[model samples]
Structures are given as C-alpha cells and as structure tokens.
Target: MEKRNDPQLRLGEEFFNQPCLSLAKAFLGKVLVRRYADGTELRGRIVETEAYLGGEDRASHSAGGKRTERNTAMFMKPGTIYVFPIYGILLCMNVSSEGEGAAVLLRSLEPLRGQTLMRELRAARRKEGAPQLKDKDLSNGPAKLCQALNILRCFDRRDLASDPDMWMEREPDTNPAEPHDIVSAPRVGVESHGEWAEKPWRFYLRGNPCVSVVNKDAERQSGSVTDNVRSLTCAV
Candidate 1:
C-alpha cells in the first residue's frame, strides 16, 4: 500500500514513449492522481482506454499531420496531457504517446480517493440539484471523469510525468491485468471515421463496473443495466 504522505510512484516519460496501442492496454489498473492547489488529493483506477494512431489514422485529430491550435497538444512530447472540450461543455482527457501525433484517450476510471469531492463537482455540473451518485456513475466516462475531478482546459499540454497537479501511478505490488481480464472493441463514437472506426482500439477491463461500456457478453452476464451501461458519446 502507498503511504499517505509518500510521493506516489508515477509512470515516467519512458513509460508513455511507446506505441499507443501498448500504452492504452498498459494503462488499465494504473492509478490516476489529482493533487489540487489546496493539497487535497483525488484518486481513481484507470479502467478503460482508447488508442488513436498518428497521422495515418483518420480518426485522430492529428491525422494527416495537420497542426492546429486545438490539436497542438497531440504533437507534444510523450506523457503530455491533451485535454479538450467537447460541445464547449464537457472535457475529455488523453495522454500523448509514441513520439508525436499519437495518444490514448482515458475513457473511464473507478473512483478511489476523494469520493465526496468527486460527487460534489459532478452534482455542481448537472442541471438537477444535489443527488446521490453511485460509485460507478461518478467517473464512468471521459468527460464525466473530468467533471468529477475538476479537470479543465488549463490542464491541456501538461506533462503527466512532471506535473504537480495531475499524474498517473502504479502500485508496486499490483500484478498486470491478464488477457482474460481485458476486452477490446471499436472505439466509441468514431464510426464517422469509416474504416478506422472498425479498429478494435478501445480497451477496457473485463467485468469492471467502472468501464464506460461493457462488452455484450459482460453486459448479458451482469444483468443489472446500470452496472454495464454505455456512456453517452460526446466526442472522440
């Protein structure tokens, strides 16, 4: 177990300087830590990820190597955070991977520390008044997780390896997730990309309630609709 005051074991730049697909799969079960200005820390375990290959991949914002203000972070060094807003309302988080133009979107996570803060932020963003939020509902989607954690546009292009506010860590004693424990499917909300939409780039932990979308088999077995419900698509 990690000590309360000890610095978390963060994944370094070298860890993310690999193929996006590899990094996407490896992200599962790792912990995402958010250290606020007041020193309050929030934690969650990554449960789902989607890989976007570089320029050749039509679905990627960096496709065709076109550089734009909105996608500049996607070309930054590995381990950089690429945050962007969708519909001017929701924020999505992704980590730059490989050398350039490739990244892995963080699709969902299981809430770990600071549940109350996550609930408060989530409730504050919704139209309805304060209400009970189930653990799974707290951070089951990319945008939802960002809102629950108060992650905003300011975090865009931040270096995950060195950023004081946000970073990813792995437990020293935790075993890597086995093949049977992972599921890969076409990325969510990328059908508009034609052939690229069929690529099984979305990876999620099998049977993890925190995953945004459960595989058909997992959903059928779970029976509880909420447990395996798919999240609403906001953007890629």
Candidate 2:
C-alpha cells in the first residue's frame, strides 16, 4: 500500500496523544482508512469506541499492569495499533492512548467507501450457508468492522500515524461531534469486571445507526457516573 500524499488529512501523533477516555470520545466522527496491497482504499466513519484505563481497568487486557506477548501493543506509544483475537477466531482493533497500557477500542464504524469490497470480505468469512449481510450490518460491530476492513492480527503494533496501509483522518465534511451528540454508556461485554463494568467508558455518536448497540436505559443511568469518570480519566 502506498502512503497517502496528503499529510494534512491523516491524523498525527498529537491527535492521539490524549487520555484513553478522551480519545475514545474523540474518535467519533473520525475517518478510519485502510489501503489494500492492490491500492483499494476502504474508508469508514468511526461511530463507537470504548476506553480501557490500563492497569486500573480490570476489563482491560493489561489489567494489573500485566504484560504478555499478545498485549504488548497496549503498552506502546499513542497511535500504536492493538489487534487482538476474540472467540478464538475473530479479531478486534484498538489504538493505544496516553497512560501506560491505556487504549481505546474501536467498537463500530459506518462504512463510507468500498461497500462492495467490505461486503465481499465479510461474506468470505461467513459460513457457506449463512445469510448474506446487509449494508447496515457490514461494519457495525468490533469484529464485524475488523472483517469488513481486513484488520488481522498482523496489524497489531503498527503505528496508525505512519502506517501506509492503515491510518485515521479527520472528517473532512463534518464538524466534530458536539457533547450533546455524543452518548456515553458502560462498555459492552465486560460485566465480569465488577464495578468497572458499569463505568461510562463507552462512547458513540448519538442516533448513529451504525453503532453496535444502543442502550437507552444505560445512557439515562450513566449521567452522573459519566461526569465522575471523566473527571478521573480525562486529566491526561
């Protein structure tokens, strides 16, 4: 994949050098770009993300400051890619943020380019008898977006700021999401982590159809907790 010549469009280190929670919110409305070896470019609008506060985040892979071969990317500098497997076969993509081992999980994306290719890639991964995927379902979840974008374990540890094959860019046509347009709620699939599971660490664009899940009750309950968690985690 060739590097994009327009440096102005690609996000730099400064964009990612923020606290995990801040980065998670900031990711909303941004554009994630992936370039294939054949020069096929796939683009998506980031719609949902989750923050993991490193050693203090019990649900994080690097919980208790524990490091392993699989999770070293979480300890890397901001903008480092952290691709990890789930359910033994599927993968999820995250980006390291400020603080030791802290990272932001990219929970969902709205496909903006290469829809046909994204659908093809996704279909290739489905079982032979599985139903065909609709456009709305192409990249609307963590592992689903990975499949749509062809994000494999080999992408782990790459620098999103400099990687030729993959990078993030600001949304060229839209303003950054206003606070009122961003929804905060507890992260998904982390209930086993005790109280940490209830932290309002997951963020998404309000009313975005591509978001993986929309929990209205959770959002209503998270108002105060969101402010508390923000004060603790947004200090950078």
Candidate 3:
C-alpha cells in the first residue's frame, strides 16, 4: 500500500505537471478528505467528473479569453479547488489544472465516511419535507456532494495544498467503477457555445446514485436530457 501521506500534505509542484483532464480522469475512485470546521473529517470517493479546458475550448468558462470573476480560478495553479454555483442552486467543484489556464469541473461524488454528518446537513430540508437523501443521494450532484462533504462557497479558490482543512487522499479502492460503464455527454447549459455544446465531454459513474441526473428534476425546467451516466471523462 502507498504509505499514508501526511494529512497536511503540501503536494510537490511536480503534481501540477500533467494533462488536466487526464489527471481528472485518473481521479475517479480516489478519495477526498475534508477536515470540517467542526473538527470532524469527512470523506468521499470521486465517482463523476467533467473536464473544461480553458481558452480554445468554446464550452469552457474561460473560452475566447472571456474571463469572469467566477472563472478566475481556471488560471490558478494545478490542484486548486474551483467551487462555483450553478443556476443559483447547486454547487459544482473544480480542480484547477491543465495548461497555463485550464480546469476540470468535478461534477459528482459518492459519499463515504461522515455520512451521518452529511445526512445532518440535509436535516433542515428533510424537516421541510424536501427530498430525503438515500445514502446514495447525499452527494449525487456537485452542490449536493459539497453539502454531503460540508464544503461551502468559502472553499472557493481555496488552495488544496498547504490547507490541512481539506485534502484528497488515496484510500482503499472501495467500489472500483469501470471505464466501459462510464458515459460521456456534452455539458449542460451554455447552448450559445454552438458546436461546443454538441461535444460529448461529460462523464459519471455507472448506476451510481451519487452521479448527478443529466437534465434531471424536470419540474425545474432545465437543459436537454441524457441518460449518459459514467465515472470519468478525459477532454483529450
């Protein structure tokens, strides 16, 4: 087994030297550890991810050199966490990396440890008769996964390196997902991107309840739908 890395690991600069989405694809099944404000650690295994290469990639937030305050993290160093809101509802997290300016959006994860705590985070909603999270639903979507892991907008642009508060760990291979079972689809939203919108670039874990529902929650009236669920995608 790879030795347990220091919980307060400051990854060497070399970790940044890799193809962004390829690394993102390799992230599947890896565990992310969060030492919450309450001093309790929460853990989740990555089960879904979406790659967003900057600049030339039309569907990317930093495409066409259009830099917005929200997308500034794309230009940051590799391994940086880029957390953002979607439709003012869900929180999607991204790991900033790739060439000089690029990023890979982490679309979903399967909650592992501290699940009781995750369910607690949703207590208010459950009390209000909102959808109760089955063990699988806790971290299904980006924002939902954040909630399950107790990650807040405060984590936006937070340096995953040097921050003992949170870091991803290589844990035991719990339930290894397969590449064949994985699926890819164009990202949701940004129809204005034209051809980029038609590009199949999204990936998620097969049959993972934690994987986000593509064009789900119909009552909300959103983007085109797809059954494209998978565990990983590399924007190669």
What lDDT would each prediction earn against the true structure? 0.87, 0.91, 0.69
Per-model TM-score, in order, reads 0.88, 0.90, 0.77
For model 2 the local lDDT of residue 234 reads 82
What is the full ranking by lDDT, best candidate first?
Answer: 2, 1, 3
Task: Write model 1 residue lDDT over 47-132, tens digit each, in one string.
Answer: 99999988999999999998899888889999989999898889999999985699999999899999999998998888875568
Model 1 CA deviation exceeding 4 Å by range: 1-8, 217-236
Candidate 3 residue spans exceeding 4 A from truth: 1-13, 125-127, 173-178, 214-236
Q: What lDDT tens digits, residue by residue, belong to model 3 across residues 24-105?
A: 6666777777785556777787877777777888888788777788977778888888888877866778888767557877
Sort by TM-score, best first: what order?
A: 2, 1, 3
Report the error of model 1 at residue 2, Å: 11
Q: After superposition, how far is residue 178 of candidate 2 from its true place, in Å?
A: 0.4
Q: Tell me the deviation in Å of residue 34 in model 3.
A: 1.4
Model 2 regions more than 4 Å off: 1-5, 221-236
